[model samples]
Target: MTDAFRFFLTLLDLAGLILLVLYFVQMGLAAVLPARRLRFPAPAALKFTFVIPALNEGLVIGATVETLRALAPEAQVVVVDDASDDDTGRVVQALAAQDSGVSLLRRTLPQARQGKGLALNWAVQQLLNRLRIDGADLTREIFVIVDADGRITPELLGEASSAFADGRVMGAQARVRIRPSVLSLAPRTLSGRMLEQQQDMEFFIIRHLQHLRQRWHSVGLFGNGQFMRASYVHEQFRQGRLAWPDCLLEDFASGVEMRLAAPDHRMIFLDSAVTQQGLPDLRRFIRQRARWTQGAMQCLGYLPRLWSAGMPWLARLDLSYFILGPWLNAVIVLSLLTQPFRWAFGAHGLILDPLVSALITGVNVVLQLQWVARYQREHRLNTGQVLFTLVSLPVYGFALLLSLPLAYWNHFSGRRTWDKSSRHVEPGEAVPSMNGD
Candidate 1:
């Protein structure tokens, strides 16, 4: 029995070493390979339609409206109030009454918070109805999706429009980060503040990697701050495929569909275009990410399509690795942690022995620190914050690693309800939008 267990442990170690090496190699290639040179035309005088799908978001709705209005006074803002029993609809209705550019689409029971996908679909129909009445040209406009507590600056509008000038690119995703008030954090709320900074670093790393994937002309949309060409979205909605994604992670599923719907249709990641979001409670964060994992797992249904020769091999390989992440994470964590026990029990030649694990951990941290040093100007992490984040890597990483198992539990238990993320955007929590390097 002991020998059998040791053999399994050795197998896990081998898997972990392979995954670790593959991960770093891919990241290195992405970092070192010179970006493909493709010049986009200058930013057009593009009109934008901002869609905010809200459910009981009264606290932050008004501020969201004000910030967006400040950024683009001429852009059309549509607030889809999904039957919030609170004053969410009322707040937006008043704003719509006051501002000519702002419009409110109030939805009641039988169609409320059914899911964000359906709520967004409802808003799209209303937008289409409004546009048809006004004789607006869909081809000349862009559709931007923003969360209720998210903020965007006007500068991103022009930069994103320039990306869409290629005509082949269907979507553009902005770099998203969390920037809660550091000074206003009370002793009890310090954990939340710390978590927010960690999230900011996470976004910085993810956005940079996605930017690298652009060299292969392969990119995907994020849930918040997704900008799409209006004509394509309009056609999809007309065909009834754009809105009714069955997965709880509608944003991710929609992104995959966009990639598979046509080879010419592609998304781009814009590091320069940035969006700031506030962190929810830690408990809600787990629920949110578990849903994300399941959503990603659900996208496994699209594997056959992604593997088709129609898609680029680079994108196909990336998707396969991403889908295997949940399982690999468990192997990686166990292999790294159990090496000492295995060695003490007469195990030998393990791929992830204690020394090797330490080496891997050291290199990973050094790479992360390099990212911090390069973008410290944009992230604004202090000495204490940096130290705390360095120490907290395991905690943050384990949090995601656990999600794979949680997703399995959700699937096996037949619990597929969408638990909306709790919103707590207090006065000081809304971060002012800024441009990224």
Candidate 2:
């Protein structure tokens, strides 16, 4: 082979090797990580206040409230109703009347301060004041933040509270399960599997690595079912406006801020603390992904400060990957398409080496299968869902590519609003309890 051809082959080989390493590392982590189980200390005295920030969640608010009541009867559940045109507030109010543990705090947005973050900030302020006036012990009160659509189980809450018993831990993130749907097409199914793969890698491998290094920087917060030290949250908010008002990916931004503000604090992933929410339909799923991709790129605004402050290498890598992965995949696909032209124009070989392409493609297929089987086994998803994921790989790749431009557009336009996901509750369907991580 000529020098140019040799260099191309070498590059392909390196990419294949890196991809294989990532796949096996994920598999090893999945196998080795223990299943998360919440174990509370005797006489669970620590108090928890659940915060549900809702924006036009009229349809699912009642179900969420009912689930919370069942899971944490002793804990206070506060519903922060962001200005909704629908009957969300009415629903919350009705539930609050029926259950004393439930309380409603309604906030109408000023034209200037309209955003999920602002509403969350308002709620946090109220919660802080309540804790202060009641003389609640800082160490004993935990603030649990759940989304309007979030469904929690009894065991999940139990596990979260147990984590609070460890005084050094600042927060705990729950395992979030996206519900499977029979209506899923190839793209949607593959997209769901990819999301699961990302979560499994983050929760099992990346998190463990961070913990082992003892340079635990908040990577990303699982928004729906996470518990935090109330005092810590209050202190951060007091320093500046710290809520999920206008963020497309508020959970991630909050996690980054929490890590920056408190280097000593530790956040644990409760593999057991579980919450379930409906998967988005194809269009909404693409939009939601685009928002995340854009938010991740926007997080680059913090890179300079993070680097200057001497952030850990792993943390920096984590953030970089979030910002680059989608775009990189797009570039890789484009490069493959242009390969024949490059070879025809030049003196080098015309096509990607068949062996190299076959090896890489085979590895990719195996990795996807491994993840699908693992997720199916662990979650007990129906065989149809598993098969759906297998068929959707190509469609998922296209959707990811589609997200690149959307991400860029949203970031520049300063339109970081939360888009509500479609609900998927069926009559007589058994709801699984939340696992406390």
Compute each candidate's TM-score over C-alphas.
0.88, 0.78
lDDT of 2 by residue, 1-437 (tens): 37876567556545645645664564455445554443555534688888988877776777888888887788888998878776778888877888899999988756322655666777878888987998988778888888887777668766766667767677777766554343433644555555543433334343444333233354357577767787778777777747442466677676666666655666667656455554434566677678777666666666665666556677765655554555554445544655676677663332467897797678667766765676577668687656655656566567656766777677678776655555555335544322211
TM-score of 2: 0.78
Clashes of 2: 18
Which residue pairs overlap in candidate 1's backbone?
Answer: none
Candidate 1 lDDT over 1-437, as tens digits, reads: 37788678767767777888998877667556655655788766678889998998876788888889988888888999888877787787777888998989888888676888888877887787777788887777788898897788557887787888877878888878775645455768766666676777788778767867776556656768888777777888877676437777787667777877788787887665545554535676678788877766667777777887477788888766776666567676666667787667767546446887898888777777777675566667688767776765666766666666677788668787777776665655443222211
Candidate 2 CA-lDDT value: 0.65
Worst 10 residues of 2 by lDDT: 428-437
Q: Give me candidate 1's TM-score against the actual structure.
A: 0.88
Note the Cα lDDT for every prediction shown. Answer: 0.74, 0.65
Candidate 2 local Cα displacement, residue 150, angstroms:
1.0
Q: Estimate the overall C-alpha local distance difference test score of candidate 1.
A: 0.74
